[model samples]
Target: MRRWRGRFLARLRAIAPRYPPRREVDRQARADMAASSVEGGLPGRRRANPSMLPRRIPLYRELIRATFQPE
Candidate 1:
């Protein structure tokens, strides 16, 4: 009985290759599709430092600070 059960389980396992679970497959598919140019997507983002400004715009910071100060 043990031999037969083992053989049955083995045959069942052999019949199928181990595929990633459905959620992982869906996530990879989404990532791949998004990576393609046709999908019009970017991988990540960048943010500029708050204090970083062009030398030409030195007065812009002072102007903004004065404009928005609480009355």
Candidate 2:
């Protein structure tokens, strides 16, 4: 058990830089993509759907549209 654990840790250290954990790499990649794809200051996650806006509040909808122009 001790030998296996040591080997595992050694292997992990060796591969840490060459191949970081998938989830972390994916998250960083997603952040980069979001930054590059941004039309305004807002990220991809905050993208608003105009159709979802309430019909009763046209002013608020217009403000949102003015703030976030489509790319």
Q: Model 1: residues >4 Å from true position, as ranges?
A: 18-71
The parts of candidate 2 lying over 4 Å away from their true place are 24-71
Clashing pairs in 1: none
Q: State the C-alpha lDDT per candidate.
A: 0.34, 0.40
lDDT by residue for model 1 over 1-71, one digit each (tens)?
A: 34434553454344334432322223333323323322222222123433323331445334323433334
TM-score of each: 0.24, 0.30
Instruction: Residues 1-71, candidate 2: write the lDDT tens digits.
Output: 34434543454455546555543333333333333333223333355643322332455334333433343
Clashes of 2: 0
What is the lDDT, from 0 to 100, of the residue 66 in candidate 1? 45
